[model samples]
Target: MSLEIRKIVRFEEETLIEGYKAAETPLRMFAVAAVVKNPWAGKYVEDLRPIVREYGPQLGELLTAKISELAGGAENIEAFGKAAVVGLDGEVEHASALIHTLHFGNHYREAVQAKSFLSFTNTRGPANAPISIPMMDKNDGGRRSHYLTLQFNINDAPCADEIVVVLGGASGGRPHHRIGDRYQELKELGHDIENPAAV
Candidate 1:
């Protein structure tokens, strides 16, 4: 079997809440999620939930590292806050597993003597997990792309100034076409392919 991994699509945004303030010290929240491609899920595999559960901790580690880098360092994560994991399409159950693994990121705060506070949206009734942000792409030729967005909010905390956010997506080779070279070749051949959907 041939395996290829690519980030077919990605989006990131950060903002400094200038005037925002928390009522208590060491107050903040963090959230992270990944959209992974499970090649062997729901097909040859008898049970994927267990596998996803096992992988959740690993994914959490990756997200924590990314957030630590984004936050400048683990020392700066004093006011740890609410954290969550959300999965996109074909990943509902995986989201629950990811949430279980999210706590692995809190270990970083141990060295700083800071409390790591976080919560995961449950998979049952009122506690059902929250879906990450929805991503959509459409073209005139019936070509479409989709993605999932993860979101986190820091609430009422002062010890931490900002929360580092990270997102990971899984992509197979299906949507990995290169447009730059194709566009150039098309132009050279007197074909207009300009204004391709700016994803």
Candidate 2:
């Protein structure tokens, strides 16, 4: 079955000043959301995999394209994440099903040529619920600077039988990132950097 998308929402923001200091360049953040009709609303499906298989890749392609465009290009996106909100009539697992699959995430990961996993959030809520997409460095999760979140809400989304799926990205880190990355802390604490399992 094809995805029945009601609307596609796009959000972008730029920060030029932080901590009373100008950033070397504007730090930009972007997100694209698709409001879709939940196929199994009001019914408990024994297996959610079928829908996940059918719709996940489609959403991955659609949102990745939109988010990449918003960030200028996939190559320009330094950080990335995703989120989903299932309507009150649906289960939280429905929200999770749409996004927590390789069929969905692989598209974004491949588009950006990323090594690290994409960050994500999923929940069940009513219209205009707060949607927070936590992000991390596309290639280096240990990088503290690229740790960020893109939060936005659709005033009339997930209307009891709908779901809002989203993808978010950033051109770079915060305007003034002073905190060093986690890897640095590991070294300072004398952790065995060579064997990752020890840490």
The CA lDDT of each predicted structure is: 0.35, 0.92
Candidate 1 at residue 186, lDDT?
Answer: 58
Runs with alpha carbons beyond 4 Å of true place in candidate 1: 1-5, 8-33, 39-50, 79-91, 102-117, 121-199
Flag clash pairs in model 2: none
lDDT of 2 by residue, 1-199 (tens): 6789999999998988988999998999999999999998999999989889999999999999989888878999999999999999999988999999999999999999999998999999999999999999999988999999989999999899999999999999988798988877788877876664575
Could you tell me the C-alpha RMSD of candidate 2 in Å? 1.1
Candidate 1 per-residue C-alpha lDDT over 68-144 given as tens digits, one digit per residue, 9 for 90 to 100:
55545555443332233322222334334444443453443343233323323422111123323322211112122
Q: How big is the RMSD of model 1?
A: 19.5
Question: TM-score of model 2 relative to the true fold?
Answer: 0.96
Candidate that scores best on TM-score: 2
Best by lDDT: 2
lDDT of 2 at 54: 94
